[model samples]
Target: MHHAESLYEINDDLTPELMGRVDEVIQRYANRAGALIPVLTECQKIVGYVPVELQEYVAKGLNIPGSTVYGVVTFYSFFSMVPKGRYIIKVCMGTACYVKGIGEVLNRICSEFNMDVGETTEDRRFSLEAVRCLGACGLAPVVVINEDTHGDVSADKIMNILDQYT
Candidate 1:
């Protein structure tokens, strides 16, 4: 299917440089079977998120349908369609964490940041997410900001912890 205007026209952020990078990635894996995933991965690394425009661009480059690209992007939990914040704060909501009052911690972080779960702050400084588990039951009520994991976090300590990121 042909679009009225190119994806670049619709999205101001889809610059020529980004399109060039996408083209390079597609060219590198054009003849390879199952190249969509790797192409999308490389594009996402450069652009942070796989926007609809990027997906369409990838589809066109790979000579595939846009729906196929969309399917792959949506099917993968790690793929994000929207831009992520500078800091991604993941609150563990596992049974152990819940029992230890993770709810309060989550609430405190959201209330302080003025953002709900899976939402990014207006400043794009932080994105809050309540995950099923962080695989650290021993450190019940854990909060991971980027690569730094803070175990045994208390609701009151959320601010101090976030301060380190800024």
Candidate 2:
């Protein structure tokens, strides 16, 4: 966070302070055996999401190939390149939920929020994602906002449920 000439060009979200933290993460794991995943994980934690710029920075710092970094990032479902919303709304797309009218619920959210799956709203208030299942078939048509689960979610009631989040 100290005021200093930044070596790398600053990114939109990757502020000089965050870049400094990323530098610390790289230096901590540099030259260590099997450090790529851990380094990327920590850096992603610091920066919220890992873009190509941070991947290249970590690769250069660790003396590894950028493709190797990109591969690991893309392979891992947990690593995200884009910034996530404050609330992550995961709609269940499993057979039970689908049959129970989860599609209507999903569509309502998309139409209301003007965003599709895997995309965040312009205000970054919420991110919509379609997941295979949430393991609550009894509560079909489920939508999970962050850690809290809402079962038996109807398209009509989805907006009200989302109001709690907003």
lDDT, candidates in the order shown = 0.87, 0.88
Candidate 2 CA-lDDT value: 0.88
> For residues 1-47, what per-residue lDDT tens digits would candidate 1 score against the true structure?
32423556787557777777777888999978999999999998888
Superposed on all Cα atoms, model 1 deviates from the true structure by an RMSD in Å of: 2.5
User: Model 1: how far is 151 from its true place, Å?
Assistant: 1.2
What overall lDDT, based on C-alpha atoms, would model 1 receive against the true structure? 0.87
Clashing pairs in 2: none
